[model samples]
Target chain A: MDAKTFFIYLLVMAGTTYLVRAVPFALVKEKISNPLIKSFLYYIPYAVLTAMTIPAIFTCTGSYISAALGFAAAVILSLLGQGLMTVSMLACLTVFVSELLIR
Target chain B: MHFYKKGLAAGIPIALGYLSVSFTFGIIAVSEGFSWWQAVLISMTCLTSAGQFSGIHTMLIPGAYLDMLLSQFTINIRYSFMSVSLSQKADDRLRGIWRWIFGFFITDEIFAVGVTEDSVSRSYMAGLSTLPYLGWTGGTLLGALFGSILPERIMVALSIAIYGMFVAIVVPELKKNRDVILVVAVAAAASCVMTYVPGLSRLSPGISISIASVVAALVGALIHPVREEAAEDGC
Candidate 1:
């Protein structure tokens, strides 16, 4: 895509995403009262994060074993109550070391 | 002022985490022929990883504007769900133009942090968004500019950071609550099936995530409905 075409298409992508968020967020002023709906909303963040992570995480580093090593390291460190930055950086390091071993 | 300070503090972890992820995004965008300025522009104007990937992929197809539009919607549809959730979490001060403006800044990470708050004001939201936005944009500029300089192995390894962050977010909560454990397991299992199954695997990642998470969360909500008393000032 040329510069001009890229610029317009970028707007299309950005516009769609922004509107998707802005519309509901701006319009939904009333509190949703249904217990079921509330529960669903409460669970949405966890569910989305999990669904996006699994399987994807395993293949993230482009090597099955290395990515799995990263995954294991992340879960272990997190379970042991480490902070987000620590777990993430260490997981990357695990993948780096494990990739060398695999090679 | 205190709220903004709290927001800035909260954003640090997310900013640290974003540096790598957006850095990867930068490399990919530049490698795919985008100029550093263009790549930074995309990052500046967008907040989603998957959607940006789809956008760049669409650029490869000549005259695929409609394709880009539709895919971005589906890929980013989760933000709408998150926006709805955040709408409920916003304080009285956050309304009208405030919601419209700040809502555009909402992403998975921001929403994740937002819902943890009892309420959000525009100032706090501004502080919350500031560093992560800069991290994303700045990281992209560096990556696009230095992409060819980085070793392939290092880039590949650094790619794991975001997922590791996700695991870190979910695991402690999973350990503390059985309901969370079940929800995560069901979502992960469903995600695996969608990823590996022949026909199902063809679906876009966003659609797959949407389906897997909504179904699992549905099961959770049915099994353990949040008490209505949790809602404040029901009128």
Candidate 2:
């Protein structure tokens, strides 16, 4: 793409992204009172994170076995209260080693 | 100042995670004909993985402008819900211009951290956001400049670290709350069905995730309403 068109594409992409993020913050100034809505919001973080993690995780690495090993390592380390970096690094290491062994 | 420090501390893992993923993005962007600086610019401005990847594909394939716009909107609209949920958690002292300024940084990882906080302040959010922003853009620049230099195995390993980070964030909560387990299970099941089922498998990642989350959360809320007494007790 040319410079002009690239610039326009960036502008539109940035604008749409910012709008989606900003509009809710601008509009929802007051606390939500409804029990159902509040509960739904409360559960969103866990629900979204879970949905994003699974199925996708299995496909992340070259082989499903390596990915599953990484995921299992992650869960165990995290449950042991390791820091995020630690858990991630260890899990990656597990995937690396497991991939080599599997091959 | 204390809260800012805490936020930065909390953000360290997120920044590190971003570094690896955005590095991969940088490699792809450069191969797609973007200059190193252009790829960095995309990361700095967009800060979204799926949307930018899709945007680049649309651009490279000579798609119409409307198609690019629609694809970006569809991929990123989840942020709207996340932002609204976070607005309820932010400290009341955070007002006016700060909201818009900080809202720009409300990516999924940041939103997850922010919503889990007991009380979120503007400075805390700013400190939390700045490092990951730098990591993303900086990693992109490096990746574009040094495309494919890393060994395949190492790159594959680094690529999966972000998922590890996500698991780290959610597993603790899942352990503490039975309701959380239920919500996660429902969402996971819904996502699996949407992903693997014959007809439903055609749904895009964004739409499938959104549907699974909303439906699961709604089911959770109906089945396990937080009683007024329990809510007050926690607060």
Candidate 3:
């Protein structure tokens, strides 16, 4: 990446992220009373995470089988109420082992 | 207890957890052709996993500036909610322009830990955030600089760590929040459509993800308008 292009794009990424965090913290003191708006914000995290993860996660690894194994492990561990670190590690381990076997 | 000391102690678990995720971020970002500094710069500049990864994915797609702007705003808009809630928890020390500086540090983990306290001071917030921030940035540095030495198998496995993290975050919530399960499914389906559809595939991933997130969240908001009492209960 050209240094300039990379820097400009990063500024865009960092700048928007900062504003989203900073504007509300610095300016908003009262509760957001609008239930509709509140609901939108509330669901934004889950919606965004799911959209980014699906389809993309399937193709992240070298093979679909390994990625599926990892994805399954992640979901099961998470559903079992495991922590982020535990779920991530175990999922990766599943892929690592499965990929080795598949190869 | 000294405020910073107490905060540092409280922050250890979050720091350790960050080490794992950000390490994976480092390896994948570098492997994806980002320079070591570029990856570290991202970790330092944006203390978020989903947003950072989404940013890189958008950039790699060479998405338009408009796409980049909208996608980042959509993915990270959740932070505004967290920061707004934390504003109620902040002490006088986190006042004035310093709120901007302090606000930059409010990741999901930090917000979870910070809100449990009666009131958070600049010192306490600083102490709490310092280690996790450093752990995140430093882990990225290590992963970017040295991650290549690991066997390709391990690296391949590591590639999916961030997505695993996303699943970990969303799955537990989905199990408990029946409404969110449908909302997530809706968003995922929307994303898949954009990916697999012929003409729609030409739309940048940034635009596609943003549109999907917004549409699904809108559906969620419309379906469950978060009654006033429920909204209050959240705060």
Query: In lDDT terms, which candidate is top?
Result: 3
TM-score for each model: 0.87, 0.81, 0.93
Alpha carbon lDDT of each predicted model: 0.82, 0.79, 0.85
Tens-place lDDT digits, model 3, residues A23-83: 9999987777777888887787788888889899999887999999999999999999998
Clashing pairs in 3: none
Write candidate 1's Cα lDDT for B1-235 as tens digits. Answer: 9999899999988887787778878988888888899999999998876678657877777887777777677557767777887888899989999999998899877887877888899989999999999888888888899977999898888888778877987888777666677788899999999999999998767667778988988998899775564322110
Candidate 2 lDDT at A33 equals: 74
Interface RMSD of 2: 3.3
Candidate 1 backbone collisions, by pair: none
Task: Report residue B145 deviation for candidate 2 (angstroms).
Answer: 2.8
lDDT of 3 by residue, B98-213 (tens): 89889999887788689778888988988999999998998899888889888888888888888887898789878866778778989999999989999998887767888888
Would candidate 2 be rated incorrect, acceptable, medium or high by CAPRI criteria? medium
TM-score of chain B of 3: 0.88
Judge candidate 2 at residue A78 and give its lDDT. Answer: 92
TM-score of 2: 0.81
Model 2 chain B is weakest, by summed lDDT over 10 consecutive residues, at B226-235
Runs of candidate 3 exceeding 4 Å displacement: B61-63, B227-235
In the range A2-36, model 1's lDDT, one tens digit per residue, is 88899888999889989998999999977677888
User: Which candidate comes out best when scored by TM-score?
Assistant: 3
Q: Candidate 1, which segments miss by more than 4 Å at Cα?
A: B53-55, B58-71, B228-235
The recovered share of true contacts, given per candidate in order, is: 0.84, 0.71, 0.84
